[model samples]
Target: MTGPGLRREVRAGWSLFRRDMLKFRRERARIVSSLLQPIMFLGIFGLGLKNVLGGTGPFQELDYIQYIFPGVIGINVLGISMSTGVTIVADREFGFLREVLVAPISRLTIALGKVASGVATAMFQVAILLLLSPLLGLTPGFVQIVLLMSAVALLAIATSALGVLMASRIRSVESFQYVFQFMLFPLFFLSGAFFVLDRVPPWIAFIANLNPLTYAIDLFRHILYGDIELGELSRSLLLVNSPAEDILIIAVISVVLLSASVVSFVRME
Candidate 1:
């Protein structure tokens, strides 16, 4: 593309991004609910499970709340990022999407802009969670926070793309929500977010291995638990892959999903 064409595309992408952000800002209920849902999960599940799982087996030395903190954040990121796609379905229904579609810029720019907005919103919620981390007795330093944010950002890229891909095809908001939740819950449960993957049955493990969120959560634990020493069993169960491997896997998924979503948007009616 020539300089002027590139500039026009950049401006178009930014405009789409800005529009989503404006919507995000005006939705007061969305901001409140997004933060509340995860806190409820962390508090209710963390406290409840602590009694049952704490001071037992691999969790004997680990703080159960601390162990699942990153997992909770992963859930939040995954959920919010994917929900961003719902806006597209709504846009189509309300006729706003047609305006953007008529623009001369490539469809890829529009898809990416939407994804970028979702990533931004997810990260914003994550910042709030990280601030509340110390309340749960988890204190990550500056560098640790940066590393965690970087990983979460990458995870958001793939998830948001997946959402956009689905939204591109689904015509109704109701249907998109139904289909998204159907997939989202399974991804979270199979991600080892609440339990160790290694101890699960072979069938579950095999399915979890294919889930992108599984590697994402495992990557979170790998970073958050980097300095903490763990027993052989705990280490094996928690850290599914090395940092390098986790990043590579998530990166590959992000590329594939992003490419597919762009194609979906290009073909979208």
Candidate 2:
């Protein structure tokens, strides 16, 4: 604790990551349930809606399932990653987090560790969805596959930071549910997950542009389609700016939220 160094942080992060993974292994039912819900959404909602809606627009030539695969992956990342905050609350209520708080490490290290573990679990779920995408008519190239994975990692990190920030603020389970409902739905709806941003109203478009999840969805969509450049949407009248710009904004937000969360956790201790 005398001086924070790269090696110290990495070691601390890995230790916490391993501990959380072990806890998750013990709660296998919860893990499976969390993963299954998204898979069901992909199968029922994506496939079922495809039957009714038909095909994607000019910008996207993929089938319904393929088009939404990116969005589905983003959703899984957002949902599972943000839920890690609840584990912190549970740890606090059960007195386990108190011991961790007193440990000889920076609170930032602890927060990073928790976020890393959550991201890992979320990535696992995303990978499963990707593997099953072929049945949904997705035949992404090797490059698209790599880009998709990178996008998932970025999203997982951003969402996890937001979760840590929320967990630091909320003190009870009931309040957590209320906040989760208030925050999660709006993020998903405004993210252009279910529809194109151009199809929405101007006011809603403005809000969607501001949502970090919007950048995430756009990034995934850009990679999946391989025909459209996400940066163009950002440059157009929709006022999304550029893909790099959105990436920078998201990165800044993640860092700020994460730093604030770590400060709050340390203060609480």
Candidate 3:
């Protein structure tokens, strides 16, 4: 039998989930902007850089736009998913979180519900971008498409957890915006989002390897093109030494971050 606390937590999660959905329903402009930004990046940067980087070896024999679509998609998912934390902070400032906290629900449930809502919204954004990927020349078979979606879903969940953790630690929206800008730009730039990692300097490559975003980008690249050497991909980017090892690392990281965020939220006053 579940304890009173556990039941309250579950009920609170449902309530928070409904509230988040309603908030999104009211913010139609933000929703449209999130969906449009990725598409614009794909059309402008992806295709615009295609010609100049066309002869580059890593991207050789493939259209540059097609080669980079997976990475771009991954970046978009990361940004949108991570940005959900802003909403949490906004709620706290606006007294919505305070009202919710007065209820019997466990803090962990509130955190989980926020992350789940963010992940759901991110998945929807990804779906919209994916539908337009064909215009950018990404045509995958049924199984490949499923694999791609799975990879993005995993990425979304991980980033959402990270976002929740960040939100829990910050008290003000202004502070969060500054911190997020600093955190995300470096993470995105260090990642192989716009260029091949191997071609980057040794120091930069080392840092990129340490960045979780690199592993995510590599995983998505494999799913998209299957051009990269699985052995090199596994070792250099993921530091896992094998495909199974890489998957294990990603699974562990995602689970740990998610759990940490939930626990932190539970402990929050």
Candidate 4:
């Protein structure tokens, strides 16, 4: 791209990013509702399960919430990415998409703006929960906290790009909703976000390994509670055999998703 063209892309992306962020902040109900589910999982599901599990065996000496907090963060970020896709579909339905489509900037830039907004929303949700981490006995140093946020942002980019790719292919908000519903929970549960992947059967472990969210959650746990013994079953279930490998795999996946989203938009009617 030429210098002027590149500058235009950046400007366009920023404008779209700002617009989405403003809309996101203005919806107080949306913010509360987006957060309510994760908090419920932490309170009702985690606490209820804590009584039954009781830090035994592989669980060691921690409560269930402590075990699942990383997973909850993972779910929260992934949920934001999925919700961003719905906004893209809604834009298409409501006619704003036509204005975006005819803009002088590249389509990829427009897509990146949308993806950036989704990443911000995901980070915002995670930050709110991070403040409550001390109650769950989780704390991280400055560098560790930065890495955790960076890891979540990368995961958001990957998932939101994938969301946009699907959104570009579908015609209506209802059709997009149908496909996203089929995708969301399976991605969350199969990621082993709420439990130990190690404790599961071998076949289940294999299935979990296929999910990209698995690597992101593992990264979160390592950053927050690095010393915990997650065992071979859980560790082996990770697509990356080592920490460096995990980072490399996630970086590659994020790039792939961006390319896919761009191609998908180019082909859209």
> What is the model-wide C-alpha lDDT for candidate 3?
0.75
lDDT-wise, the better of 3 and 4 is: 4
**Backbone clashes in model 1, listed as residue pairs:** none
Worst 10 residues of 2 by lDDT: 230-239
TM-scores of the candidates in the order shown: 0.97, 0.86, 0.87, 0.92
- Candidate 3 error regions (>4 Å): 1-8, 226-243
Question: What is the C-alpha lDDT profile of model 4 across 74-186, one tens digit per residue?
Answer: 88898888678878889988989999998787888888888998899999999898988888878777787798999999899898888888888888888888888888777
- lDDT of each residue in 49-116, candidate 2, tens digit only: 88776643432344566656667778788888888888888788889887888877778889889889
Report residue 157 deviation for candidate 3 (angstroms): 2.0
lDDT of each: 0.89, 0.75, 0.75, 0.82
lDDT of candidate 1 over 1-269, digit per residue (tens): 88999999999999999998898999999999999988998888899999999998778767888878888999999899999899999999999998989879899899999999889998999999999877876678888889999999999999999999999989999999999989988888898888877768889988888888888888888877766779998788668788898889999999999999999989987
1 against 2, candidate with superior lDDT = 1
Which candidate gets the maximum lDDT versus the true structure?
1
Q: What value does the lDDT take at residue 177 in candidate 3? A: 85
Question: By the TM-score metric, which is better: model 1 or model 2?
Answer: 1
Candidate 2 displacement at residue 241 in angstroms: 6.7
Q: What is the C-alpha RMSD of each candidate to the true structure, in Å?
A: 1.1, 3.5, 3.3, 2.4
